[model samples]
Target: MPSLVRAASIVAGAALLLLAPVARAAPAAGGYAALGDSYSSGVGAGGYLADSGDCKRSANAYPSLWHLAHAATEFAFAACSGATTAQVRDRQLSVLNAGTTLVTISVGGNDIGFSDAIETCVLGTDEDCTDAVAKATTYTRDRLPADLDATYAQIHHRAPNARLVVLGYPRLFELGGCFPGLSEAKRRVLDRAADFLADTTAGRAGANRAEFADVRGHFAGHGVCASDEWIHGVTLPLDESYHPTRTGHAKGYLPALTGVAP
Candidate 1:
């Protein structure tokens, strides 16, 4: 009797299990294409893909990281080092298409002379920094709008179905920390220029009906001068200087991309 009762209980449990509700399936992963310059390529984040060569697309970059997180069916990492807006429009747009359901870009900095401004500011006199900042500022405010318009239009046309997300630059410094490293004056102008660039990029993103991922807030208190720095301060191998560190991509860029892309 005990053996029979145990068998009956087991059968009843199995029947209940079979009748339990099934969980719904997850949403289909979209085709994601990462495009633009070194920021998107992850220049400073390290762990470079050897085939990427001079472009230095880091495994740790936000796009690569995002791709890993989503495990998307297709991912085209097309961003390159030193890529200007025209360069992106020419070289990288090929990966985008109607099939591509997600796209993210971090451009306009090169077009507005961010690297040049930083170079002059870090290596040149105060006057030089001011002049470089002034030139980049002028172009960013006046001419960059049209350049961005063209690029955004091309991207939208290429991936009409994709969710287009534009990631903006972060302020590279916190006021007093870099003190002796860069004059407070120089840091001020550089950060100011970064804000201008962000505003310009955000404006264009809105105009083109795309989402803008603003990373400045995430990078706040984590610039070069901060104790917990996400940006490098005049490091070796020239190209890495002033670029986001690995933590920057993970904590800064990644979250920004998530907020807008999702």
Candidate 2:
């Protein structure tokens, strides 16, 4: 009876040793680093984290929501409100390294005078809005691509193993809304600008061998003019306008980010 028990224990030890290699070969948990502008930082979503300060890094942002869904080995949230591509390259890229496995960036809108165009549409004359939209389109065509390429190159160099996802901006207005202040013509202009930004951003993402989130139609039924809007209209605090609401981040951007399969 003693000899039989010894043999059984030896067999169990051998089986455990054989399975050890298989467990070690399994994939590890992700390491995520979030970067980019106010869109990524949750400027209008409100309830900013205590230590976030001017970055306005909200607990409800898409990156934060995505982080909640996936438990990462290393998580760094470096996105800031009012950040441009240049700022991201200079300030945020330092947080990422070769070990990073997942990254999300929302940029390029600020580079082409996004806020100026919005202001012109809201306050300036119809002709001024058209001119601003036209200029923004032209800028997107000529300059935005190079800016994106430089930034993407830096990110690729820093986090060589990361699966980078570049998120696009959403169209702010809908066809008709309860407010009834903004003209459909102006809406079309801004809509075209948004489309141009998405196209440019997608092109750059493809160039970098990264995924593009393409958030164009994600906020379709819940634009700023919708009955139940996901985006904020002109708020008293100028920075809040044209930014996503908490619902927008959850329903719009979070799904888009998750679709990339971290």
Candidate 3:
């Protein structure tokens, strides 16, 4: 199965390179620069990038997907795996200039250790998961927004005319009866965390004069444990458990682009 997957990936990579034209040398005008972490990188998604050293930076990532669809004149894709809000401001934002026209970001998950919280809580006993959720919720409510505010401020300062769009985290758990392995209490915890992330991102975007892409609704019933899930759960056949599938990236990029484009 692994070998077959590799073979398929090779074929897809070849096709993308062959089909993707070296976009008419991007004009000097400002275009788009995407910033964030693994979610924005589209780690498990396929087709979009010329294989670079950053293994996590997939071509199916929202930025690349949007870029291909729109053929944005200039694109600076600085999003990396495991990036926090601080990294978005410090490392990714530095690439922007006055000419940068559009900006999209998906961050803060790493800030409050969101993934780790899910791993520990979602798979644990109900009471344990609830406690984890409480702790995570507190952290997310207090710190996550502040970090995002700083990131948005930096982007606005560097590229005032840039239209910024913040992508909310996708729902990582389904409602009742989705994943049998997930206890009701555990599912509730995951649901709350996802909601908190969405609210925080939306609020921050509004505070920063930016737009918010509500991804949670689009991913409903297709989270970690859904039979036709887009997000990988802590289960078999999904080596990376907790990332989006190729189709997931394709689905996510469309809405994200719509939110950012003028």
Question: Which candidate's lDDT is highest?
Answer: 1
Error of 3 at 141 (Å): 1.5
| RMSD per model, one decimal | 20.0, 20.6, 7.8
On lDDT, the stronger of 2 and 3 is 2
Per-residue lDDT of candidate 2, residues 2-121 (tens digit): 256543443333222101110001122338888888898888898888777777788999988998888645678888876778888887887787788888999987788866676666
Backbone clashes in each candidate structure, one number apiece?
0, 0, 3
* Residue-by-residue lDDT tens digits, candidate 3, 84-203: 777666666776789998888888777776655655553456777777677778888887788888889998998888888888878776766753356666777778887887897898
lDDT of 1 by residue, 1-262 (tens): 1256544433333222112111111122339988888888887899998778777888999998998988745888888877778888877888777888998999887778766676566566789999999999999989999999999999889888988999999998899845547788899998999898999899989989899999999999999889999987655454677789999999999999999875
How much lDDT does each candidate structure score? 0.81, 0.78, 0.69
Reference-based lDDT, residue 150, model 1: 94
Cα displacement (angstroms), candidate 2, residue 207, comes to 1.0
Shift in Å, residue 89, candidate 3: 1.6
What is candidate 3's CA lDDT for residue 123?
A: 40
